[model samples]
Target: MKNKYNLLLSLMVFLFSACSTKDEVNIPSDVTNLRAEARAGSIMLRWDNPSDLNFLYVPVQFKNPLTGAIIKTNVSYLTDSLLIDDILAKDGEYTFEIYTVGEGGERGGNTLQVSCTALPRTPVVTEHAEKIDFQVSALSANASDPTEGNLANLIDGDLKTHYHTNWHEKIPFPQWIQFDLKEPVEGVKFVSWNRNGSNNANAEEVYITGSNDGENWVEIGRILPDELPTTGGAKFESKMFYKQDMTFTKIRYNAKSGVGGKAWFSIAELEWYKTWVVVVDPERN
Candidate 1:
């Protein structure tokens, strides 16, 4: 009986140890940048496809970004990407769970939970910050689709998808693209780039402007070389500041500025930004 008791105790200890042992779970460390763009009353959620992941069944959750309460019914797709209508989200904290769905729907995600709330989407600048949640810049390869050339979302590095719905015959030189910010913008960042280490007919120039509506525009900044160099296309960002509380909504840049009268550019990207840090002046005696 003594021997049996000892054996039972040992078995219990072994089982507890096994249970306590940290089992390696599939939790992606790479922050999957997610963004929701509100278009025609719908919120499109786009995030990076997890690496080293074969197939993912993500249980995408979203709520009032204000309150921590769980929003219902948004528990939708296990798809590679998710696009849900705004009507589904309550409006506080928008959370997502990527289910590492393997063969037979074997789940392995959300074991280590991660979340970000979706408030009113209001960007208010404080003393330290220009605006709350003012996405300074993002560095994610998956932000834009390589093949389709589409972009989406503001922060969390979701690419705002845009391209010539169809290919052009001439492949228009000095390609130009623009973006429309929903709210009032006071800062514009001209993000433009071209191919690396290959200057053939690659001539690229860039310009910037702002506006109240999406139509009327005005030049706010410009960048050009003193003289056109033999091998140097525009490759940098110019942080432009806007004053007078002017509401801006459009972004336009030279896509493929012709070089030596013959060369079109395959623009890698053009990122735009908006910062509203309003100051209220007080009179002093």
Candidate 2:
């Protein structure tokens, strides 16, 4: 019988070679129109590649929903876009995944999850108030008294001009005065007045210092003459208030001793105050 027709043609060629090796895999074609964008520490992805031609590459995966930590990458199907910044700006959301990879690494059709959110690392303050000016050699009297001495007449917001420091030649006993707040300044509030009447070259052992490079000085308040106040004219006013907001750019009014035993030291007015904090970063817009 021709060997039973050659064993039925060899079992029909072994059932067509087991159905062609079980359909030889080949799933691949899912990666199109996915998008995301949540900046401010980063998160930006986009996609649309898989016209299949055996596409080949686009595996990206990133999940760190609080440390399940897993981050892989491979997006080059001609790059659609991706920029996930290392995660963690107080982290609260992140889990992106893409698919479609053929050329044998076959993994396609459905896997494009996305959910990102990051934009708030805190930053947006603004305040402003100013009053600090006295420039012109930035005054720095160590001994004035050239006839109503002019250390810019003690900041010129005048209270009847006065500021005599060198009684014709006598500069002993810690006599000082400095200025230059050209910049740097923190919550400082100082005010002064004296020399409007007879307090005998007033300005007793007062000490109010601050510096940001005039050689490290930092006291910031002190007064004497019995803390001023003697019945009106606000008693030779003085009001230092630096609640420790240190950040001076320079301001020194030393005067260790004066008041009758006078070696020279007086003032009519001087003022200072600054408050300008502006920090904004609401995702840069």
Best by lDDT: 2
- Runs off by more than 4 Å, candidate 2: 1-40, 43-76, 84-91, 101-129, 132-142, 151-174, 178-186, 189-273, 276-285
Q: How many clashing pairs per prediction, in order?
A: 24, 0
C-alpha lDDT score of every prediction, in listed order: 0.46, 0.73
Measured with C-alpha atoms, the lDDT of residue 30 in candidate 2 is 77
**Shift of residue 143 alpha carbon in model 1, Å:** 21
165-242, model 1: which lDDT tens digit per residue?
A: 113334544355455455666666544444334444443355566666656877776656433233433455555556
Clashes of 1: 24
Cand. 2 Cα-lDDT: 0.73
Please write out the lDDT profile of model 2 over residues 163-253, one tens digit for every residue.
7788888778678788877778775555676666556677666777888888888787787767764321243434433535568888787
